[model samples]
Target: MSGVVFLILLLLGLPLAFTLIASGMVYFAQNPELPTAVAVQRMVAASQSFPLLAVPFFILAGHVMNCSGITKRLIHVSNLLVAWISGGLAHVTIVLSALMGGVSGSAIADAAMQARILGEPMQASGLSKGFSAATITVSALITACIPPSIGLILYGYMGNVSIGKLFLAGLIPGLLLTLVLMLVVYLQARKKGFAPTQANPPSFKQILEAINQSKWALLFPVLLIVTIRFGIFTPSEAGAFAVLYACVVGRFAYRELTLSDITTSLSESVSDIGMIMLIILASGVVGYAIAYEQLPVSLTLAVTQVTEQPQLILLMALAILLVVGVVMEGTITVLLLTPILVPLMQSVGVDPVHFGILMLIMVTLGGTTPPVGIAMYAVCNILRCSTTDYVKAAVPLFIAVLALVVVLALYPPLVLFIPELLF
Candidate 1:
C-alpha cells in the first residue's frame, strides 16, 4: 500500500524526499502498533553517520575546482590529448569527463560543467546541439564509476562494503567507459564528417606541455587514493583532504581561485548538501520500512527460486538497475535501493564490490537517460536542444554503453582485477 502511494507520488512529480517520508508515514499509519516517532529518530540518525561527512566536503571541493579555473586547464589538457581525433570536441568531452570524475564525483555536475564550457564550441564547430548535449551528458557515466564517486561512496557506506575496495573496483571500468564512449564518438563523427579540433595530431612536446599545465588537477585523484590506501586518511577523511587540496592547488598552484569564487562554491555546496541530506534523512524511514518488511529476504527468495546462478542473478539485477536508472535520480536510487539489492547479490555469491561498480554505473547512467534524467535536462537546457533530437542522437551511444555494461557483467575480473591486486 505504501509502495503504491510512493510510486503515485513519484509519478505526480512530488519531491522524492517528501515522498519517502510520506510513504513511510503511511506504513506507520497502517501498522498503528509502531510508534510514529521512529521515523523522526531514523531521520536524525541518518545524518549522524560519520562517513556521510564526506558528502559536503566533496561537494565543496568540486565547486572550488570548477570556480578556480582548474576545469578550464583540464579541458585544455584533454583537448591536446584527444581533440586531434575525428570527433574533436566530442572526444574532449569524454576524456574531460573521465578526468573530472576523480575531482567532481558527481556526474550531473561534470555534465553541466562541460555543457556550459563545451556546448557552444561544439555547435560552432558544426555539431548539432542535440548531439553535443547527448555526448556531454552520457560521458558523465565515467565519473559514476571513478574513485571518489559519491554514488560509489554511498553504496559502500550503506552496504558495509570496504570503501577502498569499491574505489579500486571502479578504476578499470571507469577507464573502459572512457574508451567505449570515445569509440562511439569516433563512429558518429566519422559518419557526420565532423573535423578534428586540431588539423594534425599534437606532438609529444605539446602533449607534455599540456600535461604540465594541468598537473595540479591531474594529481588530485592519485593523491586522494594514495592517502586513503596508506592509512594517511580514511575514506571519509579523504573528503577533507580533497577540500584542502583543491584550496591549495587553486590558491597557490593555479593562482586563480578568489575569495568570491570560494563564497560562491560554499553557497552552491550548501544547496547540494542540503538536498542530499534531506533525501538521506527521508530515506532513513523508507529504509526502516523495507527492513521491517524483510524485503531483502523476500527478494532473495524470489531470485533464488529461478536459477540461483550467480552470474544470471547479477545480470537480472543489472537489467533491473538499468531500467530503474532511466527514471530515478541516481543518488536517491543508490541511497534507497542499494540496501535492497546488495543482499540479493550476496546470496548468489557475487562480490559486493564488483556489484558496487556495476550498480553505480547503471544508476548514474540513468541520469543521462530520458523521462526524468537530471543530467539530460541540464545539458539540453544549456544547449537549448530539443528532447526528441537529443534522444535520437543518444540511441547509438546508449547501445555502446549498454554493450559495455553487458561485457563487464559477464567478466567479473574486468571490474575486480585491480581491487584484488591492490588489496
Candidate 2:
C-alpha cells in the first residue's frame, strides 16, 4: 500500500525528494512502533559518507576548469582538428564533445554549454536551429561516459562498486559512441547538404600549433588516469588534485582566471553540491525503506524466475532501466536503482563494473530521448527548437547510439578489455 502510494505521488509530479519523504512518512505512520526520527537519522547518515566527498570536489574542479579558459582552448583545438571534415562544423561538435568530456563530466552542462557556443554560429552559417541543437545535444552523451563522471561516482558510492574500474571501463565505449555519432552526423549532413564551412584542411603546422595551445587541458585526463592506476592517489584524492591542477592551469598557464572567476566557480559549485547532496540525502531514507521491504531479493527472485539465461536477463533489465530513465533524472535513477540492481547482476554473474558502465550509459541516453529528457529540454529550450523538430533531427543519432549499446551489450569485452589491460 505504501509503495503504491509512493508510485502514485511520483507519477503525479511530486519532486523525488518529497515523494521519498512522503512515502517513508506513510510507512512510519502505518507502523507506529517505528520512530519518525529514523528518517532524519538515515538522511543525515547518508550525507556523512567519506566517499561522497569526491562529488563536490570533482564538481568544483569541473567548474574551475570551465571558467579558467580550458574549455575555450579545447574548442579551438577540436575545431582545428575536425573543421576541415566534410561536415566540418557537425564533426567539430562531436569531437569537441569528446574533448570536453574530460573536463565537464555532466552531460546537461556539456550540451547547454555547447549549444550556446555553437548554436548561433551554426545558425549564422546557414545551419538550421534543429540541426545545431540535435548535434550538440547528442554529442553531450560523450561526457556521461568519461572518467570522473558524476553519474559514475554516485553509482560507485551507492553500490559499493569500484569507481576507478568504472572509469576505466567507460573509456572504450565512450570513444565508440563518439565514432558512431560522428558517422551519423556525416551521413545526415551530406543528406541535408551541409558542407564544410572551412575553405581548406588545416596544415600540419596549424594542428601542431593548436595542440600546443591546448596541451595543458588535454593532459588533465591522462594525469588523472596515471595517478589512479599507479596508486599515487585514490579517486577522492585525485579529485582534490584536479581542483589544484585547475587552479594552477587557470592562474599560471592560461592567465585567464581571476579572483572573480574563483568566486563565481565556488558559488556555482555550492549550488550544484547542494542539489546533488540533497537528492542523495533524501534518497537515503527511500533506499532504506526499499531495502527494509526486501525489494532486491524480491526483484532477483522474480527476474530469475522469468529467465535463467544471463544475457536475456541483462537485456530485460536494460529495457526496464531505459524506460524508467526516460522519465526520471539520470542521477536520481542511478542512485535509487543501482542499489536495487547491482546485487541482482552479481547473482546473474555479470561483472559489477561492466554493469555499472552499461547502466550509466543507458540512463544518460534516456535524458536525451523523447517525452521527458532533461538534456533534451536543456538543448531545445536554448535553441528554441520545438521538441518535434529536435526529435526529427535526433532520431538517426538515437539509432546510432542504440546500435552502439547493443554491440556493447553483446560483446562484454568491449567494456572489460581496457580495464583489464590498464588496471
Candidate 3:
C-alpha cells in the first residue's frame, strides 16, 4: 500500500523529494508507533556521509574549470586534432565531447554547451541541424563515462562500490565509444556531403601549439588518477584537489580566472549541489522504504526464478534499466535502483564494478533518448530541430551505441581491462 502511494505520487508529477517525504509521512501515520523523527534522522544521516562530500567538490571543480577558461582551450585543441578529418566539424563535436568528458562530467551540460558553441556554425556550413543535434547529444555520453563523473560517484556511494575503481574502469570504454562515434559521424557526413572545415591537416607546429596551450586542461585527469592511485587521497579528497587545481590553473597558469568568475562558479555549484543532494536525500528515503518492504529479496527471487544464467539475467536487467532511464532522471534512477540491483548481480557472481559501468551507461544513454531525455531536449531546443528530425538523424547513431552496449555486455573485459591494468 505504501509503495503504491509512492508510485502514484511520483507518476502524478510531484517532485521526487516531496513524493518521498509525503510517502514516508503516510507510512508513519499508518503506524503511529513508528517515530516521525526517523525520517529526520535518515535525511540528516544521508548528508553526513564522507563519500558524499565528493559530490559537492566535484560539482564546484566542474564549474570552476568552465569559468576559468579551461573549457575553451580544450575545445580549441579538440578542433585542431579533428578539424582536418572529413566531416571535420562533426568530428570536432565528438573529440570535444571526449575532452570535455574529463572536465565537465555532465552529459547534459556538455550537450547544451556544444550546441550553443558549434550548432550555428555547423548549420551555416551546410550541416543539417538535426545531424548536428544528434551528434552533440550522443557524443555527450562520453562525459558521463569519464573520471569525476557524478553518476559513478552516486553509484559508488549507494552500492558500496569503489569510486576509484569505477573511475579507472571507464577510461578505455569511454575512448572506444569516442572512436566508434567518430567513425559513424564520418560516414554520416560523407553521406550528407559534409566537407572538412580545413582543406589540409593541421601542421605539426600547429598541433604542437594546440597541445602546449591546452596542456593544463589535459593534465587534470592524469593528476587525479595518480593522486588516487598512490593513496594520496580518497576520491572525495581528490575532488577537493580538483577544485584547487582548477583555481590555480585558471588564475595563475592561464591567467583567465577572475574574482568574478570564482563567485559565479560558486553560485552555480551551490545550485547544482542542492539539486543533486535533494534527489539523493529523497532517494535515501525511497531506498529505505524499498528495504522496509523487502523489495530487493523479492526482486532477486523473482528474477532468479526466471533465469539462472548470469549473463541472461544481466541482459534483462540492462534492458529494464534502459527503459527506466528513458523517462527517469539518470541520477535519481541510479540512486533508486543501484541498491535493488547490486545484490542480485552479486548472487550471480558478476563483478559489481562491471555491472556498475553497464548500469551507468544505460542510464546516461537514456538521457540521449526520446520522450523525456533531458540531453536530447537540450540539444534539439538549441538547434531548433524538430523531434522527428532529431530522431531520424539519431537512429543510426543510436543503433551503433546499442550495438556497442551489447558488445560490452557480452565481453566484460572491455570495461574491466583498464581497471585491472591501472589498479
Candidate 4:
C-alpha cells in the first residue's frame, strides 16, 4: 500500500515532497484502473487554488519585513514591554513570538530568526545556550496558531474550512500561550536566579517610543483581520495586501528597505514559496488517493465501531497525530492527513475549527521536539547547543505546551469562541 511505502521511504530519510510524490506514483502504478496521469493532474491542480495564493503572498510579506528592519524594531518593543521580568529575555522571547507570528507565519523561520537574534543575549544574561535554544524553538509554537499561519491556511484549504475563521480562532489561543509560557519562564527564572534585564518596566516615554517605532509591524494582523472581516479583501487578496503593505512599510515608514532588499526578499520568497507550494502540489496527489480510497469514510466506521463517544474518538486521533508529528514535518502532516482526519472529527460532532487549532498545535509542536524536530535542530545548530541539553531544557516547556493542548481539547469553546463571535 502507498502508506506502507511512504513510511519506509520516510524512515529512510527521503525528502517529504519526494516521498509524497513517490507514494502517489506507487498508488497509481498498482491501480491499473486509474490512469497514472490522474496523479500528475492532481499535483498540477493542487497549487492552482486562489485561496492558496495566500501562502506565497504571506510568505513574501514575511520575507520583505524580515529584510526591512521590522524584526529588530519589534524585538526592541518586546524588550521594552517584558524584559524587566525575571527571566526577562526568555519572557521577551515568548512575547516577541506572539507579535512576530502575525508577520512571519512560519514557525521554523521565527525559531531560526530568534535563535540567531536572542540566543546570544540570553547566554550573555546567564541563560544556558541550551535553554536559549530551547526557548526560541518552543516559543515558535505560538507562531503556529496566529493569523497568517501557513499551517492554518493549509488546514483551511485541505479541510474546506474558512481560513478567516481559523485566523480568528487562533488569536485567543496564541495569547493564552504567551501568558502560560511567560508564567513558566517566570517561575523557573526566579528559582534559577535568572535576573531581570531592567530595574522596572519602561518609562511611558520609552514605551511610546518603542511602539511608535514598531507600530507598522504591530498593526499588520489588525489590518489583515479588518480587511477580511469587512470583505475589503478576500484571504487571497489580504495576502496580496500583506505583500504591498510590507513593501510600503519597508520603503516609506521604516526607510530601511533598499532596492537590494527588495531583490533579496523576492529571491528568498521564490525559494520559500517554491518549496512550500511544491510540497503542497505533491500532497495533492496523496490527498486525491486518500479520497479515492474512501479513507475518511472507512475511518469513520472503524472509529464508530470501536467507540461512538465523540471525545474519546477525538482523543485517539489527537494521540495518533501527536505521535506522527514527532516523525513528520507539520505542514506535510496537515496536507497528508487533514482530508482523512477532518471528516472523522466531523462525524463525531467535534468542531473542525476547534480540532484545527489543536491539530496544528500538536503537529507544529513536534517540530520543536525529538530527533526529527526541524525547529529544534535549527535552534540547537544556531546556538551550538547539544541535542541532549536542548531536550533537558525543553522538558518543562514541552509539558506546558502539552498541558495547554489538553485544555484546548477539553474545552472547544476556547478555540471556537472567537470564530463564533466573528462569523
lDDT of 2 at 398: 88
Q: Candidate 4's residue-wise lDDT over 95-114, tens digit each?
A: 88888774454688888888
Tens digits of per-residue lDDT, candidate 1, 1-423, equal 999999999999999899999999999999998899998999998888888888888888899988887788988998888988998899999988888774454678788888888999988887888889889999989989887888888888889898888888888998999998899889998998888878899899998888888988899888888888778898889999898889888999988988988899999899888888899899999999989999999999998999879989998998888788877888889988999999999988999998999998888777788888888998899899999999998999999988998898899999999879878
Worst 10 residues of 3 by lDDT: 98-107
- Across residues 1-423, which tens digit of lDDT does each residue of candidate 2 receive? 677877899899998777777887888788777788988998998998777887888889989988998888988888887776667777778888777653444678778888888888777766677888889888877877788788888889999988888888888988998899888888887898887778798899998888899999999888987898888988888889999999999999999999999999999989878877888988888888888789999999999999878888888888888888888878889889998999999999988888888888888888889899888999999989999888999999988888888888889999999888877
TM-score, one value per model: 0.97, 0.96, 0.96, 0.97
Estimate the TM-score for candidate 3: 0.96
* Candidate 1 error regions (>4 Å): 102-105
Relative to the unseen true structure, what is the C-alpha lDDT of residue 36 in candidate 4, on a scale of 0 to 100? 88
Candidate 3 per-residue C-alpha lDDT over 1-423 given as tens digits, one digit per residue, 9 for 90 to 100: 666787898789888778777887777777777687876777777787898988889889989988888888988998888887877788888888777653444668778888999999878767887898999898887777788788888889999998889988888778988999999889988898898888889899999998999999989888887888779999889999999999999999999999999999999888878887887787766677677778889998999999899999999999999888887777888888999999999988888999988888888888889988888998898889999999998998889988988898889998998788877
Q: For every candidate structure, what is the RMSD over all alpha carbons to the true structure, in angstroms?
A: 1.2, 1.6, 1.6, 1.3
lDDT against the true structure, per candidate, is: 0.87, 0.85, 0.85, 0.88
